[model samples]
Target: GKFPEISLDDYECVMAQVERQYNIRCYNLYRTYRTTKVRPIHVAPEDWQWLIDNLWSDEQFQKRSKQNSINKSKQEMKSLVGTINIETYEVTLVRNPETGAWPSAVDVWRAIYMKANGTWSIPNGAEILNNLEEAAETHKERIAAAPIPLAEHFALVLGRKPNHSRGVGIGAVNQGAQERYRIRARAEAADQRASDAQNQAAALLEEVERLT
Candidate 1:
């Protein structure tokens, strides 16, 4: 699409819009990158190999219910594998051999310059717009490659029991492990809540300072 005449003010407007959509400090797309690496059970859903290797342990579920546990583990493994779909959230550009770069930004500047100088020809404007369109397609491909979030990925790991070693042993051991997992889960949740509260307080302080 051909852009209307772009003044210097228009260029600044465009820059501000870009900054709003990105974090200038990080040099990474604010909306596209993972802001936090921490996970509920320290498992990254995107780490397919790690999730496959550790999500289910055969030894932990052995006993009278050994076969049942094994079957469940297999099913859980299958489910986890299927659940890990990558997310793609942004555009990427293939570099031009002549210029060693995608021409989207350059095209924008050229278009703005041409408009400013009153030398904006339709043919040149069309080429710039075409470059931007092609670059956008590449970015879409990159966005599609991103992995989706794994919500409560470790939830399946808790309360998983191994059969008692003896033919008639008490269930105390499995119960203890389950209890510990439950307690730790609660503790982690509390910690997350505290951290969230602190963040909110800090944001509020910044807002107050801005107003002052």
Candidate 2:
């Protein structure tokens, strides 16, 4: 009679026996059955306790979750490696109290000369001096290397000598020509020195890497 076709209580006991033997909880079985076409069933309290004890171990989950969070934070910081804030100041001149006027040409020129000579004063003064020095140096070099005596050539072309020419045109053509050639030669030498410096710097980097 198959033991009167086993009562529901008897079947549950058999299932519980199998669950214990396999170290699986009965709550898992109930959940699996509930997902099927079967009507919903409540998990037994004992089975629910068994599932909580086995699956919801707090220590293991927290360690893994914390490690993942730390790794993500490190990655975010690495992405911002070169991001930084910088401050800069702009130099500007104001009216001179004593002079009661804007800067004079001579004052501006002096500032420029000082800058080129690597001398510095106040921010405004240093900026102006640097610019002036660069311009004056460039002009002086150009004049010194002109194909002919600059003042004399200007006198010839303009039909009158510059106001303070010092009669350079009548003084020494040969000497002026030599000076022009010397200036060009010096410029070439300076360019070569710059190239050598760049090469040396590159070599130093390679040497450092090799030593390391």
Candidate 3:
């Protein structure tokens, strides 16, 4: 039977929204689906069962669950942004008039923190500020490249290993696509260099033939 098609990005977005709405973690989404006994119209009965058998009960899935828990614990930056979606928050935020790009994650956090605590400076904020200060001194060129680092760019500023999403909460679902684009860009650049080298060689041969 034909089922409605959904792109992977769309599917992941839907799942993320569902998780946020229900206050359920991503790992526990399978359990929620199983408990509710609710299935999407597109999912066939057998396919749904396959998810339960192959994913819900799989050893690899369990391993990921454990890893996700560990990742959650390693998260040092807490936010006061609450349940507000990042995209929605961006609308109220001031963006660059020229580029129209949203502010950096650090700036966003500072704004949110200020709103909640009446100041950007928290009790232990000195520690974080000192770290950023040292990082800027040591990695001058790195900071110059990203004046306003958004999403995964915080990994560099915060000195923390990136989580699965390379972000704090409800990150963009197309992270995999972004990484793929980077890889493709590098490959294309390499191919272009090779082509340029071949063209240079061909031109040199033509000059030699004319001279000879």
TM-score, every prediction:
0.22, 0.21, 0.45
Per-residue alpha-carbon lDDT of model 1 for 7-44, expressed as tens digits? 45445545654764564432232112234433334335
Over the stretch 61-119, how does candidate 3's per-residue lDDT look in tens digits? Answer: 77887786676555434446443333345446654789855565556656654556455
Stronger candidate by lDDT (1 vs 3): 3
Q: What is the lDDT of residue 102 in candidate 3?
A: 54
Model 1 accuracy (lDDT, Cα): 0.38
Compared with the true structure, all predictions reach lDDT values of: 0.38, 0.43, 0.56
Residue 53 in candidate 2, Cα distance off native in Å = 99
The residue-level lDDT of candidate 1 at 130 comes to: 52
Instruction: Please give the range of 10 consecutive residues that has the lowest summed lDDT in model 1.
Output: 148-157
RMSD of 1: 26.0
Better of 2 and 3 by TM-score: 3
**Residue-wise C-alpha lDDT for candidate 2, range 1-212, written one tens digit per residue:** 65656545445555654754564443345345435624325756666556456643457854764585564343221111231110000014345779745443335334333345555433454454454455445555554454433333322322332232221122124343344334555656889899999999999999999999
Residue 48 of model 3, lDDT score: 77
Clash total of candidate 2: 3
For model 3, the stretches where C-alpha displacement exceeds 4 angstroms are 1-31, 34-42, 72-76, 83-94, 98-106, 120-123, 130-139, 146-157, 162-212
Clash count, candidate 1: 12
